[model samples]
Target chain A: MSSALHTVSATDTLAGRVLHDTGVAVAECYQCGKCSAGCPLADEMDITPSQILRMLQLEMPELDDEVLRSHTIWLCLTCEMCYARCPKEIDLPKVMDSLRAESLRRKVAHPKARDIIAFHKSFLDSIRTCGRLYEILLIVAYKVRTRHLLQDLLMAPKLFVRGKLNPIPELIRGRSHMARIFQRAQRKDG
Target chain B: MTMKMGFYPGCSLKGSSREFNESLCAVMDKLGVELEEVPDWNCCGATAAHNLNHALSLSLPARILALAEGAGMQEIAVPCSACYSRLVMTRHELQENEALKAEIADIIEMDLALNAVPINVIQALDRALEGASLESLVVAPLAYKVACYYGCLMVRPPKVLRFDQPEDPMTMDRMMERVGAEPIDWAFKVECCGAGFSVSRTDLVAKLCKPIVTDAVKRGAEALIVACPMCQSNLDMRRCAIKGMSEAEAHIPVLYITQAIGLALGIDRKDLGLQRHLVKVALPRRAVVGA
Candidate 1:
């Protein structure tokens, strides 16, 4: 199949609807391959960072390739070295970011994606309500999401006994602001 | 005039490494900088999701960036190297990847200010150290030979990062000396130590860690001062396995900059998250005053 540039739409929340409205210029990428050379996890990437930037410059998606599969999408660490190193400054991590979100919205997300999403969701949920990340909630949700409850369970007793964890969360005063922000931000996207 | 910082310690300093937080506060206080912790902060995902799924990881940090923008702070100081990397990297992506930004806005149901700047501890420290002549910034010299460990998250794949050389970064080392500390020049500073995978996959760490520790010790670092919590925890906790495969005992202490700051500030040992450490730590005799 040939790569075709799709027109960005109002529903186009990810590709070109930058909040600032000016959008990032992908043409800035110079194909330095430094993004490729510096990627620690490039071995697992479908196309290297340099290739990904080049594909973006050409307005083509690097979604195909069996071994390079969606698995490569997960392999990008969002380290920003590629962007910092790209002579053209192609925003390689954002491309990965777009592809990764697309993967989940399309429901082809790796099984592990849900677990990661859940951990983050619960992390933010704890913050949205409490106005700060509830450490206990964060760890519990992470362990629960990853299905590795026992991994950090052993540390809870020590943390609890040592007064490291506030069993009761520290609820902030301007708590309503947090919820309101979440509500409005969520609605804006909707 | 006091300079206010939007301090984002990520998950580690709040949960596991309290001392690092305490030390950082004390040290920064001496520098006349006050870190106002963001009222509401979320996990930056660190090196985990970036390795697992790109979009999920970017949005995870982007959402927090969105929240920070909602909080009204434009420049935020990130203490964790991993969190800093994720936040800055996500900022770069959201700015340059419009299509990706649109997709994320759709998925997260929010508009993240891609312009929200993420500054690392090195940058933050540099900011805090601003105005004061580097000569006058030295409170107590961390004269001990310290291995400045940046790990893979700090510098790699350069498109989004621009502070220093990936293979050999000197920003942290140069900063260390400004604070009266000796920074050991060592290879493997940017090597990966299996980070979060240290649990799901132990062998990966053993192989990665062996070289990292060996290189640090071989270079005569009295200890390693790390900007990344994952690196500090991994390098410290996995010492047994690393040493099991080695011919000599590995007693090097891995200290978070926060912990080192606590020590330099004459804070109590109990305040530095020292007891939480698996490996035994030997604080300098001068720092023993607080305990």
Candidate 2:
């Protein structure tokens, strides 16, 4: 609970870019504490949701980088609980989402939350290839990436026995079209 | 009595939660609503796409909406809450920002009509079966108490989803009552089930699932009911790791709302995919036809 704002006048232009991109009124947050108070994952976050907004208000790129890289951004479930309870109607989940996108673009990874990053990357990779998720492949890819192969091992047998896990993903006819969309998105970003 | 609507059974329904897909189709088929699959549908970009790339999220869902529109469906039913949220949110974004919509169109390389609105399974059920006689359809009434868990995405960011009351939604509860199941009043109805983190952060998901599972059990709920695949998989599959849960408490069945409805409608247990759950599900004594 750092009360003093860490203002950095040098980063105002970058801060303006964030505000324009997210359309969040970072200044209107007022650090009312309502958002964090209602957030389900606030206790696990390095900085509270209210504090994230406060950092944005201060426009400190260094603090912004830390915030973006903290496990908090990836840990956010995007559940919208904070947004629902916020008096200012700030969409904390959306803010977290935008920050996460920024984190990816800047190649900033949360050391503690790498598994989440890996999972997200693996998920998008699955979509890019098959146009839809192949559950078995996604699990294997994630397990290989995280190297936690034994984790949730018991459930897989039961899932397979129960016919929940399909050995193959039904490939949609428009996979090439989907690949084109991903390419265009990445090209525009570069 | 027959009405046609497009069904977008996102990846989860097609793979991990085939039971939800089966039960929904079975229930709808019984009700005489024809659900045509939105042909050549791809992933909806879900939470991952949105967090990693803005344009990809919008483009992935926009393509599906465009396909639904091309097939002449004014509205399509997205059973998975995450997919429903992505579709609804993308549509909302496209409607608000013409520039972004144009950009997304350029990337997706398709002219989306943006008229194929998205509706969650519950909302779709309400519309298609409006005023239908459910009282006669209940061959096996689910008389036991259940907790209706909405999870997060189905009805949140109220302005964007605009589906149900964000804080204290009761659509699922009301639907439960139609099948003679009493939906208990609980605090964590709209709580987060730590979705998408099921594989990445199973520990955190178990911790987050604590309140929802404990509250339901503490409130005398025989089962927990849900619509979202992530919520179902997390709460059901991760029951072993949930804090303050005992073997007895862990045995509480996590049922899809559609599965519960399917039970009430006397659809065969096999047809509803009830065997697919990690936690074995057995209908309560009251749910038996001649009980």
Candidate 3:
């Protein structure tokens, strides 16, 4: 959700190495359907989490529209039950994350998925300046972006009055450390 | 010197789960553990973000880890189950491949020192619980039958997050014992709670929650203990929706980690962050910490 104002040209090859990065041996996934069977969101999908990973293994470039736009990506709760169940220990969520990122790049998003996206953008915006999320700013941005500006308005006033809504966000004392942290993480990997 | 792990509390604790953080700080300090919240950390992209964008998903948690390594803190403790899982997975991925680390570095413009530190909430809890006996530190033990709920986020999608054994994680149960509560052995430990649907799809949440709650009650748990805020909120707030589906009265209270700790520490009800809760506790008025 941190805006890639820092976009690069073919800079993120880590997407490939993420297979190794996750400690999940993707090669261990021998087309076994255990992941498909264990996935609560699998039956409702045309491309199961396992299939997506299989495509990754086979190096398939083009993904189906149903798989890209459906709430299945959003439906994955990241509980990691499937990873433990996988005889190969493939992290389905990691592969799903790659698929989700691809969907974002293609601008193929679910309807309600936009509202959630708004929250993501809002969240990063808060951290970019200060080092953490600002609850008030986040909710305000989420409501405004979704055009449901008044959904939690009443609750906001009550929470603010309770000293719970701190106006000043707890950002890094000096952002030099913050910027370096971002720069360093983008560089470190599997 | 004791170990000092970097902490990233995330937005929920800064807002709704503040009391949980407060109690965590208290109990940890009393136990001689020092937790330093990561300086200027961001959201771990939560459940919704990663689903929308995978690269960005790793990017979110990796960003926080990057800061901890900068501060010379090798390990990071994330309290929220979802954040812990994502951060841990991202850390694992970053460490396995040099190319990926270089790529993420290119995206965020920083070098991520991809060491294999555990980015887990329970792992952190396990470390925190070390050298301390659960039975010895109780002023107010939660003696009720408690169903330790994992609620999907803590365990799922084998590839990205392997926080526990997946099918049957016992971290929560162990913590419950330290708090003097009887933990229930149940099948739904790794089940889904229709996450994020509490706002988008209430019916789905109710449908998923009813069974989990019914099963917990049937197993004799007076309340549910959870590590994730979203799960706690959904399971607690959607009580009416879940209750409407059931034939019998649903009377179990859903509690967060710190709240349970607060009860065991005998903190007042108001201080325990109970007011914001949706499900009412069965305990008497005085026993509600920080009420």
Which stretches of model 3 miss by more than 4 angstroms? A1-33, A42-63, A110-112, A149-168, A173-190, B1-5, B52-55, B106-111, B115-121, B156-164, B196-203, B240-251, B285-291
Q: Please write out the lDDT profile of model 1 over residues B1-291, one tens digit for every residue.
A: 788887887767775655567667776776788887765565564544443345555666777777677777778888777777778767776777788788776656677666558888778877887777654544555667788888866775553567788768888788666656779888777767766554544445566678788887788888788888778767876676664543333777888876775566556677666776666687555431222
Kindly list the per-residue Cα lDDT of model 3 for residues B151-254, writing each as its tens digit. 77666544456456667878789888877778999877778887766554556777778778888888888888888877876787666766454433366788
Per-residue error (Å), model 2, residue A57: 0.6
Q: How well does each candidate superpose onto the true structure, as a TM-score?
A: 0.70, 0.95, 0.78
lDDT of 2 by residue, A20-94 (tens): 666665666778898888888899998888888887776666887777778788878888888888887877777
Best model number under TM-score = 2
List each candidate's DockQ score: 0.19, 0.75, 0.28
| Residue lDDT tens for model 3, A58-112 | 4333444555676677666555657667776566766666556656766887775
Of the two candidates 2 and 3, the one with more favorable DockQ, higher being better, is 2
Candidate 1 is scored at a TM of 0.70
Give per-residue CA lDDT, model 1, range A1-190, as digits (tens).
Answer: 1113334333334334321233444445556577778766677545676664444444323322221235556555454556655665555665665555455546575553455455555566676667555777876777676777777556567656655566777676756755554555444332
